[model samples]
Target: MHELSICQSIVDSILEELSALDPKPKRLISARIVVGEFRQIVPDFMKEAYKAVTKGTDVEGSELEVKTAPIQGKCGDCGWAGDLPMGDFKCQSCGSSGLKLDGGMSLYLDNLEIEK
Candidate 1:
């Protein structure tokens, strides 16, 4: 699954950051990531992927915390902008279906909890 590759990338970044530190951490407790709803990433699958990818590494025992970002959009018809309910693309204020989605497509590592 693509989750495996995604986790691999995150782990790579973590290792790179850890190696750059003057005193590398003894252990990684957690990795917090934000995933937009539009990405359709399943949290369980991502966690499983992280566990598999980190096996036998310095981050093996770390937990992956996933935060879901809501889909946001702007209505072209009425110039309304706000968070849109998942799967509902209509503008809440104007009842128009011409909502231009501008958010919920991001995926990034947000924080890392490490024991020095």
Candidate 2:
């Protein structure tokens, strides 16, 4: 699935960053990632893909810590700001349909733990 490609991208980015290190890292220990709910990335599947791609590589066996951020919404009618349920943007207050999605649509690497 797309997770494979995503994992590949993660590996490429990790490698790129590692290459820039002054005393290059000997291995990666962990990777902290943030995947928004809107992205619909399955943590288990992504982890499997990462393990598969990292097999026999320097990052192999490294842990992946995924943090989830809720989808936030802002009501255009009542100016209410809060978390919103996935797939729908109904405002909690005033029951207004004019709700604008705020965040929770990102997938990025937060931090990486490396060994020297």
Candidate 3:
């Protein structure tokens, strides 16, 4: 699955960050990632992929905490700004279909806890 590749990228990034530390961390404790609702990521699959990819690595028993952000949008016609339910992009205030998605398409690492 693509989750494996994603996890590999995460590990690579973590290692790169760790290398930059004055005194490299002894081990990785956890990583917090913010994933937007619009991203089609399966948490279970991600966790499984992480476990597999991190085997025998410094981050081997580390935890991955995923935080999700809801889809937010603004209606171009009505100027309504709010969260949009899945598959329902129409504006709730004026029933306008012209919406501009402003959020919920991000995926990035937010925080990391490590042992020094």
Q: Sort every candidate by lDDT, greatest first.
A: 1, 2, 3
Scored by Cα lDDT, where does model 3 land?
A: 0.85
Candidate 1 lDDT, tens digit per residue, 7-36? 899999888887888787788899899999
Query: Against the hidden reference, what TM-scores do the models get?
Result: 0.90, 0.90, 0.90
Which lDDT tens digits does candidate 2 get at residues 1-116? 88889889887887787788888888889998888888888999989888899888777899878888889888888899999888777998888998888568878888999888
Residues 1-116, candidate 3: write the lDDT tens digits: 77678888888888788788878888889988887888878888888888888899878899988888889889898789999898888897998999898668888888889888
How far in Å is the alpha carbon of 68 misplaced in model 2? 1.5
Check candidate 2 and list the clashing pairs. Answer: none
lDDT comparing candidate 1 with the true structure: 0.89
Q: Evaluated with TM-score, which candidate comes out highest?
A: 3
Candidate 1 off by > 4 Å: none
Q: Where does candidate 3 stray beyond 4 Å?
A: none
Task: Return whichever of 2 and 3 wins on TM-score.
Answer: 3
